[model samples]
Target: MDVLAVSIFVFFFLLVTILGFAAARWRRADNLDNLDEWGLGGRGFGTFIAWFLIGGDLYTAYTFIAVPATLYAGSVVGFFAVPYTIVVYPIIFLFLPRLWSVSHRHGYVTPADFVQGRYDSKPLALAVAVTGILATMPYIALQLVGIEVVLQVMGIGVDEGSWLVGHLPLFVAFGVLAAYTYSSGLRAPALIAFVKDILIYTVIIVAVIYLPAQLGGWDAIFSAAQGSFDAFNTENADAIAAGEVGAKGSIPPAAAHWAYASLAFGSALALFMYPHSVTGVLSTRSRSVIRRNAALLPAYSFLLGLLALLGFVAIAAGVTVAGDPPNPQLAVPQLFENEFPSWFAGVAFAAIAIGALVPAAIMSIAAANLWTRNIYKAFINQDATPKQEASQAKIVSLVVKFGALVFVLALSKSFAINLQLLGGLWVLQTLPAIVLGLYTRWFHRWALFGGWAVGMGWGTWLAYGVSSPTQAHFGGPLVPFPGTETNVYIGVVALLANLVVTVVLTVVLRAMGVDEGTDQTQESDYRADAGDEGVEEELDLTAPAHG
Candidate 1:
C-alpha cells in the first residue's frame, strides 16, 4: 500500500466521520425521539443544504465507480446512465413537489407512510414499505462495491486469504459510518455531503482534464477505446448477433437503440421511486426547494457524463483488470492509480468512499423509516411512542448497513451491477401507486397492490431469465421487449403489465362495488408547503445544542 495515499484517505475519512457525529448538534433538534428529527433532519433544509444533500444522496458512490467501469468494460450501453439521470429531474419536477407537499402535511417519514394516508390501506402500505427495503439492499451493496474497488486500487487489503481479513478495511469504514449515523441520524449524511460533493467535483474535474493530457488527448482516448471495442466485438460477434452480449464502445450499433432508450426511460421513472430519493426530497424545508433543485440537480448529470468518459481514459492509459475474473469495476480507480501521484490518488479514493457513505446512510435511514412507521408501528405496536419509533429506526439502520455489507461479502462482486439493476426493476413497480396516485385516485388500493405484485413478479422472472455470454442468468438489464423483436428494459415491460393490471382490476372491482379503502388525505393536502400548520417542526440551527 502507498502509505501516503492511505494516510490522506484516512484523514479525509476520519474528518467526515467527525462531521457526521457533529451533525446531531449542527441542526440541534429540540427533541431526538421522533422520525422528523432523526429520519428527516427535522425537514428544515433550505435550498443550499437540500441541493447538496439530495445531489449527494442520489449521485452515489456506485455511480462514481460503476458508471465508468461499465463504460470501460461494455462501452455505449453504459452511457445509458447519463440519459437516465438527465430525464429524471424533469419527471420528478412534475411530481416530487406534490409528494413533498403531501408528505410534509401528514408528517410522513417514508413513502409507505404517504401510501397509507392516501390509500387508507395498511396492506398496500406494507407492500410499498417491503419493496422499498428490499430494493435498497442491493443498492447499498453496490456502495460497498465502490469502496472495495477503491481499497483494491489503493493497494490495501489486497490478498488476504480469508474473506473477513480481505474485507477488514471495508468493515472498519462501515463501522465508523454506522456509529456516526446512529448518533447524528440524517444530519450525518446531510453535513458530510458538503465535503463529499466538493471532493468529488474537484477530483472529477481534475482527472478529466489532467488524465487525458497525461496520456494523449480525448481524440487518442476515443481511438483506443474504439479499437478495443472493435476487437472485443469481433471476438464476440456471435454473442452480439445472438443478443447474448453487447459490444463495447462509445456508440452502440443500430440494434441496441431500443435497449438504450428503454433503459434510459425506465431508469428515469425508477429514480424518484426509490424511497431514498423521495426521502431526500421530503427532508427539504419547502416545495420550492424541491423545484429549484430539480433545475439545479442536472449539473450532476453533466458531471456524471464526464465521469463516464473516464472508461475511455482508462483504455487510453492501458489500464488492465487486476482480478482473476477481471472486474471492470476497478477501471476508474485503477486509472487514477496509474496516472496520479499517491497523495492525490488518495484524495480521489476518499471522494469515492465518502460518496458511498452518503447514499448508504440515506438509504438505511429511508429503509428504517419504512420499517418503524409502516411495519413496526402499524402492526407491531400502534401505541409505540416517538422515542420507541426513533430507537427502532436507529437499530434498523445499522442492521440495514451491515446487511448490505454481508450481501457484498457473500456474493461475487460481479453481481453488484446486476443487483443494482434489479433494485431499479423492483423499485420501478411502485411508480403507478406513488407517482400516478399523486394525480388520480382512480386505481383502487387493491388494484394498486395487484399492479405492484404483477410488476414485481414479471420483472423478477424476466430478470432471472436474462442470460449473457458470461452468465447463464441475472446477466444484464435488457430483456426481450414483449411483442417485438427488439429488446427493452425489463422494468418498462413490467411497468406496462402493472398499469394494465391496475386498470383492468380497478374497473372490475369498481363495477362489482368492492370496497375501495378510505382516502385519509385532503385535496388541499397535496398543495401544502413550508410553514403550514401541523407540518413537522423546522430545525433551530442557530440555537444552542442544549437549548
Candidate 2:
C-alpha cells in the first residue's frame, strides 16, 4: 500500500464523515422526523447549494470512471455523454421548474407522489414507485463499482484471498456511508457535495491542463491515441472482420451516427426521470432556483468533456492495466497514480470515492422516499403520521444501501453495469406518466400504465438481445432499429412504441367513456413558488394533502 496516499485519503474520508453527521445541524430544524426535513433537507436549499448537490448527484463517480473508460477503450459513442448533458439542461430548464412548483405546492416528496396526486390511481403510482426502486438499485451498485475501482488502483484491496478479506476496506467505507446517510438524511449528501464538487473540479481541471502539457499537447495526444488504435486494428484485422473484436477509432463510423444521436437524445429525456434527479430538483428553495441551476449545471458538462479527453491522455501516456483483456476502468486512476505525486493521487482517489458517496446517499434517500410515500403510506398505512413516514424512509434508506452493497459484492461488476443500462431504459419508460402528467391530463391513467408496461417489456427485450464482441447478450446500449440497418438507442425505440400504445389506447378509453381519475392538482399549483398561499415554508404534518 502507498502509505502517504492512503493516509491523505483517510484524512479526507474522515473529514467528510464528520461533515456528514454534522450536516444534521447545518440547517437544523425543530423536528427531523418528517420527509421534508430528512428526505429533502427541509426543502430549503438555495441556488449555490443545489448547484453542487445536483451536479454531484447527476455527474456521479460512475460517470467519472465509465465515461473515460469508454473513450480509453475506443468506444466512439461514449462521448455522447457531453451532448446528452447539454441537451438535458434545456429540457429541465423548461419543465423541471414546473415540477418543483407542483411538488412544493402539494408536498410531494417523490415523483410517484406527484403521479398519485395527478392520476389518483394507486396502481399507476405503485408502478412508478416500484420502477424507481428497481432502476435505482443497479445505479447505486455502479457507484460502489466506482469506489471499488479507485480502491484497487490505490492498492488498498487487491489481495488474492477470501472475498471478505479483499472487500473489507470497501465494507468499511460503505458502513460509514450508510451510517451518515441514515443519520443525517439528504443533508449528509447536500453538505458533502460542497467538498465532492470542489475536489472533482480541482482534479479534472488539473489533469486536463497538466497532463496535456506533459503529453506534448492535444494534437500529440490525439495522434498517439489514433496511432494506437490503428496498430490494434491492423493486428486484429482478422478478428475484427470475423466479428470477434471491435474496431477502434476516435470517431464513429457512418453507421453509428443514428446510435450516437439517439443515445444522446434518449439519455437527455431519461436523465430527469430518475428519482434521484427529481429529488435534487424538488429539494431546491423555489422554481427560480431550479431554473437558475439549469443554466449553471451545464458548466459540469464542460467539465465532463474535459474529463472524457483524459482517456486520450491515458492512451498517449501509455497507461496499462493488469488483466487478460485489460480493464479500461483502471485507466483514469492509473493515469493519476503514474502521473501525479502520491499525495495528490490520494486526493484524486478521495474525490472519486467521495463522488460515489454523494450520489449513493441521495439515491438511497430518493428510493426511500419513494417507498415511504408511494408504497408504505399509499398501501400499508393510509393515515401514517409524518414521524412514522420519516421513520420508514430513514430505515428504508439503510436497507437500500445495504441491498446495493450486497449487489456489488455478490454479483459480477459487468452484471452490475448491465443492470444500470437497463435501469436507464426502465426509468425512461415512466416519463409519460410523470412528465406528461405535469402538463396535460389527456393521457388516461390506465393508458399511461399500459404504456409503461409496454415500454418496460419492449426495452428490456431489446437490451437483452444486444450483442457485442465481448458478450453475447446485453452487451451495449445501441441496437438496430426495426426493419432498418441503422442502430439507435433501445430506450428511444421503446418510448416510441409506448407513445403509440398510449395514444391509441387513450382515444379508445375516452371514446368508451372510461372514468378518468380526478386530478388533485390545478393550473395555479404548477406556478406556485415558495411562500405561495398553499406552499408552506415548513411542512405541516396536520395539513390536509389536498384542499
TM-scores, one per candidate: 0.97, 0.97
Residue 279 local lDDT, model 2: 93
Give lDDT tens digits, candidate 2, residues 318-434: 999867689999999999999999999999999999999999999999999999999999989989999999999999998999999999888888899999999999999999998
Q: Pick the candidate with the highest lDDT.
A: 2
Candidate 2 stretches with Cα past 4 Å from truth are 539-547
Overall lDDT per candidate, in order of appearance: 0.89, 0.92
How much is 182 displaced in model 2, in angstroms?
0.7
* Displacement of the residue 186 alpha carbon in candidate 1, Å: 0.2
> In angstroms, how far off is 524's CA in candidate 1?
0.9
Candidate 1 residue-wise lDDT, 1-547, digit = tens? 8899899999999999899999988868777788888999888888899999999999999898878987888667889999989998889889999988888888788888888988899999999999999999889888888898889888886577876777789889889889998999999999999999999999999999998888788998888988888899899999888887766777767988998999999999998889999888888888888899999999999999999999888888999988766888889988888789999999999999999999999999999999999999999999999999999999999999989988888888767667778889999998888988899888999999999999999999999998877898898888888778898999999999999999999999999999998888888988888767766447644565522
